[model samples]
Target: MTAVQGFVRQIDLPQIHDPRGDLTFVEGGKHIPFEIRRVYYLYNVPVDAERGGHAHRELEQVVFALSGSFRIKIDDGREKSEYWLRDPRKGLYINRLVWREMDSFSQGAVCMVLASHRYDEGDYYRNYDDFLAAIRVAAE
Candidate 1:
């Protein structure tokens, strides 16, 4: 096993602006670093409410704030950091074994997540304490 480090990767997306709104584009293995196997979005969220209280064992994800702004909290057990996602054309590339929580959403905030794997219960560590312990053990 290898040690985990928390980091954010930003991707520049192709955008087109019109009278209505701006359009951002993404294509698997092109604009996005990995082929997207699953797609999900979170909306109608309350302010200061946290979500995604889990870490994936092997899955890779790219998170984008499509509509509004939010804060992303990332932890590698040994260290933790927080990032604000406000740009629709940019995304945060989250690697494996890093715990993440999304919170501080503005009104009508839409968060889109592009995943590299299908849904699997076994791949997720839902408990924060368990995630910390696992990271500590992996670091030793």
Candidate 2:
């Protein structure tokens, strides 16, 4: 495990096997570290594209790629790290105030995000340069 400055957590779940296929489920208190208030998925996206280039002020999130694969870049106003999510049973838990970006999505990739709070525009930091500057200042 990598040492990240902020409160991002990664959890690998146990995958259940079946004769038909595989099954993986994350309940509110089981696989997820936080209570889930919102659930959404992103798919049919183009290649060489990026999404979620922002930081949340108070909302915590757990991102998982249920189908194919994708790469997530996370920064915590001090250090940064990148994670490649390819398995359905693995999740990346991002704490509040951490900037995240999702990119390099493979074909048929389905990215699912579980949030601790509902949608609020005020919780996001959408500017990349501002995020970098804030990190630089915090490190000093």
Candidate 3:
């Protein structure tokens, strides 16, 4: 996997193959860089629907496509990168202070997000301009 923005990278989870079915598991601080505190999944999304348009102040996340696929665009103040997630055993780890936008979801796509912190509206920089401004201040 390639690195992105010096903070984002692809994390490969441990997969067990069996005659019954394949199994994958994630252990916080082991499979990912941060401890997981919250878990959420998005499904039944329209093919043209878009999600995520913000950056977190202190929250880090690892997103996995449990089923189907989607595209995620990430930017770190300076550089931007995109990833197409389809495999259930791989995830995109995004650190705090990075902006992310998700779209181009395939039909029946399922996006699962493992967050390092609980949901906090105050922790979100929903506006791109404001996120960039915060990035500048953090860089100073």
TM-score of each: 0.86, 0.86, 0.94
lDDT of 1 by residue, 1-140 (tens): 12234445677889998999888889977876678999999999999788998998888888999889999998877678988999999898887888999999999999999998999999999998988887777778
Q: TM-score: which candidate is best? A: 3
lDDT value, residue 126 of candidate 1: 97
lDDT of 3 by residue, 15-133 (tens): 99999999999999888887889999999999998899999888889999999999999999899999999999999999888899899999899999999899999999999999999
Against the correct fold, how does model 3 do in TM-score?
Answer: 0.94
Task: Report lDDT (Cα) of residue 33, candidate 2.
Answer: 67
Candidate 1 minimal-lDDT segment of 10 residues: 1-10
- Return the TM-score for candidate 2, rounded to 2 decimals: 0.86
lDDT of 3 at 107: 89
Model 1: runs farther than 4 Å from truth? 1-7, 17-21
Give the Cα-based TM-score of candidate 1 against the true structure.
0.86
Q: After superposition, how far is residue 77 of candidate 2 from its true place, in Å?
A: 1.2
* Global local distance difference test of model 1: 0.86
